[model samples]
Target: MGQKIIRFSDLTGTHVENDDDLVRIVVRQHPDLEDGPVEIEALGGELTAVEELALDLVTIELHRPGADEPETVVLEAEAFDRLASATPMAEVLRGAKKVACPIPSQTAVPAGAKERVNYASLEHAGRPHKGRTTDAEKQLVRQHLDRINERLAAEGVRTIDLGNAEHVVRYGLEALARERGVTLG
Candidate 1:
């Protein structure tokens, strides 16, 4: 893929040569736009060559935001050469202040809050079945309590002591929810 950095007075993007003698331009939008980026490609055009140098004047198809169809735009040879040059497109765009659409104020909680709320709600709603506990299950519960106590001790926090295996496991889960800032009501 052959690429050229194009920076105009108003717009900035990259022009790339694709297979079948077609060229493509990809322009990044301002962060505030939120509409997405733009893409332009050459529909049909053979590059004219004089001696060994290729001429510009390439006819390109433009795809803008909310456009009904792709439009044709003619790029001068000099403009094409500038785009094909080694200049960085980002640097060129950064030189000018980008005009962007106004960002709407956020009213809802941050995106991840809903997921945390759901998780905490589910944790509080579900309880393990109180089936007959085997010696192995009891031992596993003791191990979990020991690990929780170790963590609490390391954090200089108060450790919990539950007489039964079920109580210990329940307390450990509640502790985990609290650690994640999830209030289990």
Candidate 2:
């Protein structure tokens, strides 16, 4: 399940000003976009972020890769210090994973195949405005939390901690803890 770039060409400097322009060019070059979700990208775009001169607060949005929407992890000074002094990210971050893209890519491969496109490729092309997961998706994940936590723990990654507020909100930890005779913070 991987994507192969079929074609590559460079547009003029003035062409493709933004994500909208990139989509327009993609549509213009390959008129088959209406048939499926054509993968598109615009290189050399500016990186945007906030950098305060004297910062007191820090927050990071982590797309911790399963199908769920990214979580906003607020970092305390101690937490940041621990992370900063941790081992290499590749060894520490065993939980993050790359999954199937939401966009239905216009692939030459047959239907029901995976990885024609990915979140990173389509990120600059402007993703559709979809919100968080539905209640059904949440329920399905909830049913497997025990097994999931076990596997995650074995991998040395921290399990979904009911003590963490973000995890509680994301996984409905209070009800889940009550169901399993566990306590929460």
For every candidate, C-alpha RMSD to the true structure in Å = 24.7, 19.3
Provide the clashing-pair count of each candidate structure: 0, 0
Looking at model 1, which ten-residue stretch has the lowest summed lDDT?
Answer: 118-127
Worst 10 residues of 2 by lDDT: 119-128
RMSD of 1: 24.7
Query: What global local distance difference test value does model 1 have?
Result: 0.45
lDDT scores of the candidates, listed in order? 0.45, 0.48
TM-score of model 1 (CA atoms)? 0.17
lDDT of 1 by residue, 13-131 (tens): 23434444454546563433323367755423322332347444667656666543345667775675477455664466577576575566654567677421221121211123333
Model 1, residue 173: displacement in angstroms? 75
TM-score of each: 0.17, 0.29
